[model samples]
Target: MNEYQPQEQLQNATLILILGILSIIGCFCYGVLGIILAIVALILAQKATKTYAQNPEMYLGYQNVKIGKILAIIGLVISVIYMCLVIWLIVTFGMEALQDQELMQQRLEEMMGQ
Candidate 1:
């Protein structure tokens, strides 16, 4: 006689996936939000990976965890790049130029030697 057991869904898999997607979208918010979200998603994914590894046959949705981790890494990289760009812009153009369109244009023109 044999019995069958249902597999359980990996914990935090869906949440990790959602957070990863949000991290990518949030990069437009000056990159800070995206970086925060991505870091959280990655941490959650790590926990989920460990859970899945403990009992591979007992859990499902490991793929979600993997995909989420990949997305989070991508988001983190993009967010860092964006943040660096923002910092560079602030340094080159000045924070006040960012607050004023005319000032921004003037700064851009000056930078371009126009």
Candidate 2:
């Protein structure tokens, strides 16, 4: 008779999920750190998913990969938007004005006519 051994879960599945969640939280860092985390999580998830696909019975944690991919995409989008906004502010107000918090607030209020 042949002995049976249980298959192990896909490697880095939990890590991928953690990175994904961190990316979302990191978005608060002007979307820079968040984007990096998201990208890493996405790459890991892809590798794990591909490996799992090749041998469906050998690994597990497909759900983590899927969720991580989604979070990475969202984080990427947010990062791009944040970068664009910062560029626009710099162009519109100049680098010096942006460096001064008071001036930046004043300019923003003026733009809003408040």
Pick by lDDT: which candidate is best? 1
- Model 2, range 3-102, lDDT digits (tens) per residue? 7668888889889988988888887787788889999998998899889889887677888888888888888788778878878878997898888998
For residue 82, what is the lDDT in candidate 2? 85
Q: What is the C-alpha lDDT profile of model 1 across 13-114, one tens digit per residue?
A: 999999999999989889999999999999999889988888899998999899999999999999999999999999988999999999999888887995
How does each model score on lDDT?
Answer: 0.92, 0.85
Clash number for candidate 1? 0
Alpha carbon RMSD to native, model 2: 2.7
Error of 1 at 27 (Å): 0.8
